[model samples]
Target: MKKNLLSIIILALLVVNIGMTAFMMLSVMTTNSQTAKLISDIAAALELEANGGNTGGFSGSASGNVGVSNIATFGFTGDDQLTINLKPGSDGKAHYMLVEVVFSMNTASADYATLGTSESLAGMRELIKGKVTNTLSSYTIEELQADDGPAKEKILEEVQELYNSNFIYDVTFSSVLYQ
Candidate 1:
């Protein structure tokens, strides 16, 4: 009787251990699968530039001179530029226009199209242009100069709305020319 009880206890313990190990393995597999899926999703969303090897720089100095590096090298992949004309404000001082913009889509192939389909890209371009125009119109020259935080937020919100996805990872001011 004693021997039978001992055997039953050991068997129960072994079964429990095996069950726990299997559960852990399954959990690990699930976690890894999810991670891989997330990585693929992000990669698809980025449409990462093939020429990420290219490093570009831009300077928005107080001197109103815009200097761009790598702009010429990369060339124009999509809509090349966004130019806005600002009217002098009511204060009679020519206020610098705040134009926030993103560079062209890094679409090297159909699989790497960041801006989605051509139709979506067209709509997004128009939406972005309109948003930038509207956001800039609201800011005075002083505000543009002083509060970069709000300006950046406005740009992000507009871009996110325009893209209809969180795909626009960043919004960079390609050029800030005050005329």
Candidate 2:
């Protein structure tokens, strides 16, 4: 009788351990699937924005009667126009102006063509916008339009840092209009 009871107790503990392990595994799998779905949704939204499906969806809330509109439109191949409405940042005493920038990839080389062939335009668009926004926000209007080559080089470097993918070689700005 003692031997039988000991065997049953051990079996029950083993069963419980197995059940707990299965539960943990299922939880991990569910979390991973949810993360993947979220990433997919973000990618789709970026693609839609890049392809010019809906520009108005990107707008942020207006503050102090100052609205910042994100007017983005696809231009020619490899080119995009982004209009940003600027408002005074916390300090209500700065001159706020809207800036519209049209940026394009310089696809004038054989290397560029090879890179373009490998990636979809939508992915490239997402990559470029992230790079441009990070780099351009630091400069004043005067610095961005400076005739000196260093300013342009700096911009390109910033883009390159963001995109280490071999598919992107250089970035060019076709237009920068400030209002």
Candidate 3:
């Protein structure tokens, strides 16, 4: 009968469609799992957290939990903010940044007693400014703008080394403008 044959043909096509859909889903799921694993591996290798809180700038010798009560800040603002001429990028245009650098000192550290006060650190301000200038002027605008984490880490390291102490535990660019 023509009706019976047509029904059988339609049923066969539907069955094939269902089978193909299941196969495609299985293939896609396997690839998705593989991609997720690769991303996880890369994040772990870079010591990055999923929440993206830690930028690794305060790692190494200066890393520790300093309570808010034990923290002191010395900042460069207004006329004190640094104006750095950056290294030229591929575009070959001179770029500059106006940045305010702030140092977070650990008030509880022994070094703080000798060097952490505003008056004490002011004497070394020129030297610290030079270090910041040297670190920043070496990077091209593109490089510096891509991610500032490395630059901040380098400056923090140099400052700590300059004093031979970790009393200054963090450096922050509280304000910045690039042009």
Candidate 4:
């Protein structure tokens, strides 16, 4: 009777192990399939670019100047530059950061007409400065100093969220200096 009970327990354990193994295998297979699809999509996009195709709409590519090492500086945006001054969220040491922000846009943007005029541009600049200052003040010195950090993305998102009429395509930090 004891031998029969032991045999049953061993069989149950083996069954549970087999079930878990099957579940893991299925999950892996699903992940691999999705990865394959993503690779194909990326390949197709690259092929089109190589063939000199006008890939309409945002290409979802990084738009910034490649600076020394990995640091990027993007001050190439024609006449639309917004400079901001703020102190990063400091722990002890006092550090101030100067940020030159630029937005990439086309003629179709809603803010395009207003940006051309000095009066309207001034108004927009005020809005930008206010939003950017608020955004920048939230980041820590370490975050701002990183090569690729979440602070930049957060700043862009916050600024864009506040000014929807600006019709911003991409936000670039033209220049960043910390002192």
**Candidates' C-alpha lDDT:** 0.53, 0.48, 0.84, 0.58
Give the candidate number with the greatest TM-score.
Answer: 3
Best by lDDT: 3
Candidate 3 local Cα displacement, residue 120, angstroms: 1.7
What TM-scores do the predictions have? 0.42, 0.37, 0.67, 0.48
Give one digit per residue, the lDDT tens place, for model 1 in 34-76: 9999999888655433212123211111112123431211111
Candidate 3 segments whose C-alpha is farther than 4 A from its true place: 1-63
Over 4 Å off in model 1, which ranges? Answer: 1-80, 85-90, 94-100, 103-115
User: Candidate 3's residue-wise lDDT over 1-179, tens digit each?
Assistant: 99999999999999999999999999999999999999998987655432223443334433456899999898787789999999998999999999999988989888899999778798999999999999999988898789998898889889988988778878889898999
Model 3: how far residue 112 lies from native, Å = 0.5
TM-score of model 1 (CA atoms): 0.42
Q: How accurate is candidate 1 locally (lDDT)?
A: 0.53
The TM-score between candidate 2 and the true structure equals 0.37
Candidates 2 and 4 compared by TM-score, better number: 4
lDDT per residue for candidate 4 within 19-130, as digits (tens), equals 9999999999999999999999999888665333443323222222233343322232434444344454547766666666765544454455664344655566666667
> What is the lDDT, from 0 to 100, of the residue 3 in candidate 2?
100
Model 4: runs farther than 4 Å from truth?
Answer: 1-35, 38-91, 114-118, 147-149
The per-prediction CA RMSD against the true structure, in angstroms, equals 14.2, 16.1, 5.3, 11.1
Least well predicted 10-residue stretch by lDDT in candidate 1: 56-65
RMSD of 3: 5.3
Q: What is the lDDT of residue 148 in candidate 1?
A: 56
